[model samples]
Target: MAGVRQNTSIPIPAIIRYDETDKNIIGHEFSLLEKAPGKSIDQIYHTLSVEVRTKMVHQMTDYLIELHAHPWDGYVGGLTPTNGEVTPGPPIDENFGQLPDLEKYWAGSESLESLNPIPSQGFAGFVAFTVGCLDHYIYLCILLAWFHLLRPLPSPECKGRRHERP
Candidate 1:
């Protein structure tokens, strides 16, 4: 978040505070962000003129280019609190599982045995890990859908019935 704010021209809400752990002051862990200007594109995109839509698309593409152009030190996981350093860890949500480690995903055994590990290799390992993670996610989704299908339905009385508001 900090890197995106500092390095890119993308307009994102300024993170006021981030709490990874909760002491329960607010009863939930949360991040406080400065109020962002304007509404969601969903609310107004259909109303935009062709010129405005073209400009929006161009701006979005420019932002993507600017973001991807940032030099990476070869680490492939998400940014860490260690000042943008990347580590093999759970991506976004750990509730699923962690990303594959470098040793596990490395293509060459010689590279794994090397005393001096190159950072560039990290990107390749990360890519392999991401692919495997995606497969795992798909399997999990299918399993979840099957479970939901097999689960007992709610009692008829528990189901909400809509009434006409007169």
Candidate 2:
């Protein structure tokens, strides 16, 4: 939200109140935002004039430039509220997905607990996370190769040769 607010070229909904603690709510913590004026781009995109569309693209490009210009704190994750201080943690998606969507790291109650950010050890944390995901992908590829070996695919018929199914 702060990132969007910092970029005036990007029009985002104003945050009214943000509650990270869910003690008052039934489910996950929530944030209340002021309703952004005007219809969503999805709704009016088809109706927009070519000039308006061009202007929108220019505005979006400006927003992206401004957004990317900000310096990061050398952390990989989301901002965690610890001892009333905002600290960086391992980046986790709000929907419980890992940064690169490798797999679920927790289950049941543990999933809820994982909402708290994992403390990233600078660049090492990101490196480890990436390495682990790559390893998992390689394992999956090996399994696929083994499956293909066990159940070989049928050969395609060529112009001169007649191929038989195994």
Model 1 global lDDT (CA atoms, 0 to 1): 0.56
Q: State the lDDT of candidate 2 residue by residue for 58-93, as single tens digits.
A: 988887787656555444445555574555544454
Residue 104 C-alpha lDDT in model 1: 42
lDDT of each: 0.56, 0.55
Residue 151 lDDT in candidate 2: 59
Q: Once superposed on the true structure, which residue ranges of model 1 sit more than 4 Å away at CA?
A: 83-90, 94-126, 142-166
TM-score of each: 0.58, 0.52
In model 2, which runs have C-alpha deviations exceeding 4 angstroms?
3-11, 81-87, 97-166
